[model samples]
Target: MIKSMTGYGCGARDNHKVKYTVEIKSLNSKFLELTLRLPKAFSDKELTLRSECTRLIERGKVNITVTVEYVDQTAAAATINTELLKNYFRQLEAVANELGTNRGNLFELALNMPEVISHNEEEADEEEAALLLNAFQEAVAQLNEFRKDEGVVLKQDLSTRTQDILRLLTEVEAVETDRIPLIRDRISQYMDETVGKENVDMNRFEQELIFYIDKLDITEEKVRLRSHCNYFLQALDAADANGKKLGFISQEMGREINTLGSKANHAGIQQIVIRMKEELEKIKEQLLNVL
Candidate 1:
């Protein structure tokens, strides 16, 4: 069955020292477009993680995000500069005194200044890196399962619509049977009005009418359209992803339906052709999301 490109999955794992959470999201696209968001500490493992993700997912616009939290806040907290804090306080205190404002709470203001706080971003050690990769692989597996479930629903919808077009083809054949006599009678009447009925040769008129009707025959179009519809259904049963293959088959189906419509001069057959086109348009729209 075909899998859908739209899905989401999440996974988390925690060591005694830190907790790691991984999330995966995807949407439909013609090619793979991947983006990763990670904490500064784990920047070195980005390329390895990216390669793994590419091997797992073949298509879609994908995003992977990782978050981490230390078990002990005091061990991983930001460091403050005492001298920068003191310098900021002195300048701010002088300005406040000149304005005659209250001098209290100056220390609170200085603590929040830009240069007063700084934290060194560290590199991910071997243990932490392994934990994150394990969590990420679990997330990718869950996302693939989500896609398989959605694929079953898509297969059902597409099969139903293709059957509908087949039913409509039967209707076109029924309406076509009664059309030739009407065309022949209209042409005979026109000849009577212009050249007089007694002056016309019946044998020659019948021969020309047969040749003209042959040009309007749609037998070949109907045969080709039915074949294309069957091929579309077969592609859905394949184990591998066949989204691009299905798209090409549908284009061929459209060409046959259009030919049918052009050869059908009767109003009833033309209307049936329009309905078939409607079903085909819907199939194309749904194929955009298939994987």
Candidate 2:
């Protein structure tokens, strides 16, 4: 069960003349990095919201936005700064008297200063808070649903690619087996060319041939590659949020593949190694989105 790290979901609830909306967006990340946007009144709930998102999404660069709108007049509570206004008026009266300028609009000018008409950024009631949190929960659920759906497609493609790698491995094995007899014949021909056919040292030649063939043998690489494939599938099954683990396994798989390529002296085996590398590359691309 693989899940993509990219998804989006939005949920909204309106009640008692207040409307709460929550939206979540996720993108691939090396770790769980969450950014939350909320009204000042709800700032205290940031940690709670982030924690809930972490538990749900597991890994990603997640951005969550919460908006609460008041549909009623009470939602906008304006407060006047009486002391500041009085002081402003007194200072302006003196300034106007000294400069011989009009003081008629001084009060209006003072009223327009920042913070003079402060309003309580609307706060949700307890019931409204519950609704908001519920909406957030729903958003996270929907986001994960989208990721899961994408994950199904990814899993199918990756499984196909894994099978392709296996096929290429089989081709490499065939090429490997065919090389041994070819090497024996070439060694015999070389011995005949260097020394007279009657003077050929059969025992020494056979031993040397065996040693050279063993050096070119990819049996260990094949065995380890096959084992890595099986281990990869097992890890995939056990993985919950194992993107990094999968990546590490991929590195090991690549090591074996590279070794197989380097040891391959046959043209067919080289071609198979190329195909295997292509499949592995595709798997690596898909792994980027896995969680």
Scored by lDDT, the top model is: 1
Q: Where does model 2 exceed 4 Å of error?
A: 92-109, 112-114, 122-125, 187-200, 237-241
Model 2 Cα lDDT, one tens digit per residue, 61-128: 99999887777858766789898888777888899999999888999988887666777664445787
TM-score, every prediction: 0.83, 0.87
lDDT minimum window of 10 residues, candidate 2: 116-125
Put down candidate 1 lDDT per residue, 1-291, tens digits, no spaces.
Answer: 799998888888877878789999999999889999998888888898888877887888999999887875664778899999999999999999999998898889999988798764355677888889899988998899998898899889988999999999989888888888888988999999999899899899889889989998899999999999998988888776467888999999999999999988888999999999999999999999898
Count clashing residue pairs per candidate: 0, 0
Off by over 4 Å in 1: 80-121, 199-207
Residue pairs in collision within model 1: none
Could you tell me the lDDT of residue 7 within candidate 1? 81
lDDT of 2 at 215: 98
The C-alpha RMSD of each candidate to the native structure, in angstroms, is 3.2, 2.7
lDDT of residue 138 for candidate 1: 88
What is the Å distance of residue 43 in model 2 from its true position? Answer: 1.1
